[model samples]
Target: MSESVVADFVGHFFAAGVRGEPPTGRIVLSQRRLVLAADEVKETIPLSSVFDVKVGQVPAEMEGYFNDTITIAYRVDDERRVAAVEGSDTNIDRFGTVLFKVLLNGTTALVRHPARLGGRVTDADAEKASLKLEHGSLTFKRKSGPFTVDLGTVISVERADRDLGNGPHPVVTFRHIEDGTAATSEVGIDSARKTNLLGRYIRLRYADVQEELADVSLDEEELEVLVALYSAGEGVSLSAVVDIDPQPLTLLLNGLAEKGIVVDTETGTKLTAKGRVVVGQRLESVNT
Candidate 1:
């Protein structure tokens, strides 16, 4: 094991299948191994054994304090195991972020913290993603919130065309699965190489099939219209999409209604859930 210290987070580690109480272990990540030490009952897991890590809030409890959960799943002796730990929401997150980057460093160039490779994130409102990429996951953090994703379960990553109205910004989408369904996030890519390479890497690594497309196909105009409706998120005026000529735009919008991607609401036009999924590829194509 490498002697260099990376990140060490102290917390109560709830080991899987253990007969006794949860151990107060310091989750330590060195160059080679991830160690959980509580008193003398230390369990050292090789980094290569790590398969995935899931981080999320675990139903806030007690009127006073609550913490997030970090679930680490690994393969051992051809058997899979899981351990979940809870701590200061912030520290628990560091546990996942640092460990993931270190493991991925073996395959990619992410030695220093990734804040330098700045990226923009659009979640409700546009912000910075303090983005960090690991071999098997990616994390986004900001003053408002933090998000962590397991790339192994990621289904798709794609670069979106620039929207002149929005800005000449190159966007990238990262879609992953939860509860057996797919979800996606859109973020701005400052570096062309980073966006394309990350997409190719995640898709090649996780997706079961080699092809990137679903069955549906749309021309540039059709795709653009759907993308517009998705951007509205709720019912909005058709003119918001494009009014190059009201006659042609209305004709196309109504055409999409037949496809069930859009509906003529009293307020204006809005995208149906199905339309958001299939046609919104204009939006993460919009999502499920």
Candidate 2:
């Protein structure tokens, strides 16, 4: 099979031995290796050699010249070496994300899509998939089709031990938004290193989403109203569900709407996408 190109960009490549101005080159990333081609020299680094990838941070030796950088640490000929790439701030950030995924590409896993939906267990069966990681998302390519989860919409990720035909082992279960509804997925990687690394990366990214939600505070009554709306779905009398009066329930729903958590449709009030994410987080927190 031919190696697929993962990413290609024009950036300045810097190495420890290079003096003065670094070489401006076209950086091409493939499934097996990375190639940097400049005017006179071309350097190829195998992806397997890459041990660490650092984003948004310039190495000490490469500092003072560039701001946004992606430093790649690898071993060549059994000797440790480092190379830095500099580009536009956004490009550097995006390339770093792609590079990180490329390093974890082709991981094998058993995937279960829609393992749960809105507190209800789903009937989907787990199947083997080839993991494909991308910027802000990861894909599970199964025999039937491909299923992807956007990390930005992820609410919670937890580690558990489960038996999937084989003996009980570590698995990762995460809750995310699918078609504007809360859903859960489970994955069991073939190797320990890849599994834990994938889990840690997802949690780190989810932490950013949690930070944005930090300023969003809800009182007990408000939370009760939100949960009621989430569970009972739309067009129901939320006041009856939560044992609150119509007047107070209306006020609570209005407050939630203002916070972009709930929406009042023509027929009834419903939880918005953000509302589902919040409720999903709450449910996962309670379950775990």
Candidate 3:
């Protein structure tokens, strides 16, 4: 596969994670192969299983954590099973105080620390997870809380805390599930409305196309330009490709050319091999 294709696949994989689907893609982070898929994951490393859990405040820019919060980081045997729960006391009306109470009760959930010999925790007999120090690794899992988490379905973890003045209240930030990252840079904002709408369209259309449309590296407008050029079947000036103002179209074409997706020749503008494949995939998508 081409580098652009690989980048696109990585972007989509991250995007899918941000969107909360069991992502199916291979990303070589730090030269390690991490595979995320729907059913099973291979050669994946959990951030918590390998790292240390630090209790502090999540950055203000990190969406959910407004006041104070605690974070857990460890590497899991498989990176794909990562899950996070983030909540704050401020939104108690919406998210409840289960996660916050866990932090206050000083009780850890059972899922955080798995048994050496794998076992299961059922709903009826579930208990709070405790922090266990084993072989230089700290492990624990949450027990009684609002979240009904499946051990096999987690992919990332985040936690937030709020100071209710009397004491510190904690919340769980569920990071792996799709919270509309594609629709908004930060969650829980007015702009998220539009982001969610566009995200829904991408999710709906993503699976229909073939020829590895996993990563096209083009935004909506760039994709539109490529599609128009492909549909024209001949070299078309930048103006003819889009109805929008000329300056933005020129910038988009320039960006595509820099990415090796399009070429600007003396004749006019045309799709490169990569661009053609993207256009063709999109075309097929529209037809089907």
Candidate 4:
């Protein structure tokens, strides 16, 4: 690979994977691991565990655009993960070459550069509905329905123009992670940027999900308890929540109070500052 490619490969990059357009983030190479990162997510895998690596492309609609793509599939114990990140047409070859060399070397290297600004997405539909990102899941909800998708289950993210003979316009499609499955959704956001944004956001956040959770403090039952108290004004009895029967709720409350996620008074329970912060993440999840 050329020196320019090597230089560019080491630092932060604007990477667009299977999703819409590119979201800004960086990839880190270490002696033992490879890390892919974005604003809200970080995925790291052992070099020995990475069994597959390839450079390829998805078809491009326009003539001049580069179709260069880099994809990786790796295992963490019994779990497997795959990611595809694309580079621009002019630089794709170099980017892949440099990365391949480093990984092939099988040695640790350290490089650092200030992160550059990456693409961002905004949507009007997001204003009408609530969109949240959490625990490797992306959820979009309205009165019509609350649609939740796991990032690990994502197949592909695409922005293209198709002609069914009637007309041609840009559309963004998200596919399922399962084989032989069609796209989960294919709708045109108002603009290309907005469409790209949603897809990138999902991919970036998905990287951070752990295959097996080991922390009891942040477990689902505990989070639900905080959310329940956050939603309930002043306080509500454990009997009010249907998700957990009273016995389990009773067991959970002791831990929640100890962690300061909630405050229990003689009459009822409420969220503490820490608890409110955790619950507030429910909305920030979409903002990402």
Q: What are the per-residue Cα lDDT tens digits for candidate 4 across 79-104?
A: 77665555555455555544444443
lDDT (CA) for every model shown? 0.57, 0.79, 0.36, 0.48
RMSD of 2: 4.8
TM-score for candidate 2: 0.67
Q: Can you rank all candidates by TM-score, best first?
A: 2, 1, 4, 3
Residue 175 shift from truth in candidate 3, angstroms? 39
Which ranges in model 4 have alpha carbons more than 4 Å from their true place?
Answer: 1-22, 57-66, 106-288
| Candidates in order: C-alpha RMSD to true structure | 14.5, 4.8, 22.2, 18.1
Q: Candidate 3 residues 1-288, lDDT tens each?
A: 211211112211221234433244443322122233333443343321323222233433333422333333334444423322233434221221222222222233323212111122222332344433221112333444333222111222333342222233342322111120101011111222222322222222222222234454667878888777766665446576579798877888888888778897778877764565566445546645
Residues 83-125 of candidate 1 have per-residue lDDT tens digits of: 6666677786666666656654323211111111113232354
Instruction: Please say which candidate is ahead in lDDT: 2 or 3.
Output: 2
**lDDT string, candidate 2, 54-82, tens digits:** 66568786677777787877779879888
lDDT of 2 at 254: 82
TM-score, per-candidate, Cα-based: 0.41, 0.67, 0.26, 0.27
Task: Using lDDT, rank the candidates from best to worst.
Answer: 2, 1, 4, 3
Highest TM-score scorer: 2
**lDDT of prediction 1:** 0.57
Winner on TM-score (3 vs 4): 4
